[model samples]
Target: MTELEADCSRCVGLCCVVPAFGRSADFAIDKPARTPCPHLGGDHLCTIHEVLPERGFRGCTVYDCFGAGQFVVQDLFGGAAPSPAMFDAFEVVERLHELLWYLADARSRPEAAPLHDEVDGLRDRVSAAARSPHDVDVTVLQSRCGALLDEVSGLVRAGGPSLRHADLAGRDLREEDLYAADLRGAVLIGADLRGVDLGPADLLGADLRDARVAGADLSQALFLTRLQVRAAR
Candidate 1:
């Protein structure tokens, strides 16, 4: 996942500044975009990094920009301290890069062979746009990705525990059996998945924000990333 996953050492802490969040079970307090988090130090390090979850900032741990921060800060912003405009651009670019992540994942699926060429073209366009703030178009990218995800989902959506787009939000599913589940585009916001065995479950485009997963067994979860896991408990 080199250059496709987060490489914070090559970043400028854009994740802590370019995004906004409200105080909740997942976050300690509210923060606005382009404004640094209170726990963010002068050196751009998270002051509560070591104890983020314990300090009520567990949301900070699951966010992955898929190299968007590093690419924006180092390549696009030229390694300069980000301005408000830069943050705005980063917001749009971040979404585009997220599509690249999904597209890349789709291309890796042998079941998606028919769409491989299209996925490659889309991935290249998104990757190139991610390197230039002026070229990132959020609306078009989202539409394209939506269509691509639908097409790819058809290829992988077999009969194992399908839960696509199911409204399971805020439900406590701790220690449940979710192995080989089809969880594409599922709304899992604030759902509890602690100790839930997600063996080989497909989680493409699953919204796991604020879900509890303290002891979830996701070792073999398909398309599950550190960023997705971090967004949950």
Candidate 2:
């Protein structure tokens, strides 16, 4: 199995919490922060696993915690026991994943090319942390991921664009705009690109295993998964 798959299977649905959602195209109702979905069982598995999309849970279907949830739930807590500490830590993991996704998206732009090495280094560190057997300092990692994301956000808001070699492992880019973007030799394992506009995008030699791209428009995107395309909307 791919590393992403192995990592994802270890989660306990922490992504469902730590983020707020509204009754809209992507979700069915108003979901508050740190609250579990109505469809999630006590065991932390989605009750509507087979038909999450049809039930207005498309966002849930495309979300991936990259084993962060699993590691936190099983490795750190030794089970799915609920606790204030675990919830707090889960919040940080959620933020870290969000920042990682933002950085990954920025890396696809030309302006973030100079920071590709830094992004890769961060990915390696985070991946290692995800695989660790102990609990991590969520605050520290959140700060680290937040800083990079802030840097990229500043560049993007400033209209600076540059794309080259990048690394985007375990990032989340759900419903982001990536039209005609260049992502050569990038590592994009476990990213959520659902409904992304990838028209004319270049994805040569990019690793896209376990990426959730349910509604992504990849009409001219290069080297994507045939299985992903077949499975997506």
Candidate 3:
């Protein structure tokens, strides 16, 4: 799954140039879509990367391209400099790769063994679409992946608490037994989660920004992305 992980050294900073950023708690300044960030250097590197959070660009730190940038640059464009078309394709490939990540994770679970074949089929389809992003309907793919993930979650999280999409921001949850809980899409910003055992929790799309996790056990947290971990304090 290393191919699904971001490798900035192999990318040309497409994430810094393609997406628009509004000035907020996460971003230090407003940047229009297709415009390179002011902090981006000529060599395709972030000039303030080491101090992005201190410089008020914490949003940049948690942004994950899921290796889409490098894949598009090296595999699709043969390492050519990014163009307008490449920028457009970047978003599509990113979504495909993200879906691939979840599909791969679902396949890895022994509890989801019954659906492994289906997961593999969908993963193959998503991988094909990543190669020719313009030909695929991403919304349809997302719906399929979401439905399949819901089934897999049911199998893996058997009888666990369903806190899907719950708003728990800034709440203290240190005493909760969240293990194997279905916390998909839960808002946990600034929530106190110290020493919590979150192993096997379904954290897909959960907002964990500024959430305390210093002593939390996330070793087996299902679908927990690097972005979520990085955003949490």
The lDDT values for all models are 0.78, 0.60, 0.92
Task: Please report the candidate that would top TM-score against the real structure.
Answer: 3
Reference-based lDDT, residue 213, model 3: 97
Clashes of 3: 0
Question: Tens-digit lDDT track for model 1 on 97-187?
Answer: 7787778777877877998998898888877777666855678877887788667766754446778788889998875567768887899
Clashing pairs in 3: none
lDDT of 3 by residue, 50-112 (tens): 999899998988989889999998889899998998998898999999998889889999999
Deviation in Å, model 1, residue 166 alpha carbon: 1.0
Best by lDDT: 3
- Model 3 is weakest, by summed lDDT over 10 consecutive residues, at 153-162
> Which residue pairs come into collision in candidate 1?
62-230, 62-231
Residue runs of model 2 more than 4 Å from their true location after superposition: 1-10, 94-232
Global local distance difference test of model 3: 0.92
Ranking by lDDT: 3, 1, 2
Name the lDDT value of residue 165 in candidate 1.
82
For each of the candidates, the C-alpha root-mean-square deviation to the true structure, in angstroms, is 3.2, 10.1, 0.9
Ten-residue region with minimum lDDT total, candidate 1: 150-159
lDDT of 2 by residue, 49-151 (tens): 8997798876676555534576577766787666767777665554454445444555565656777787778866765565452466757775786577545
Clashes of each: 2, 9, 0
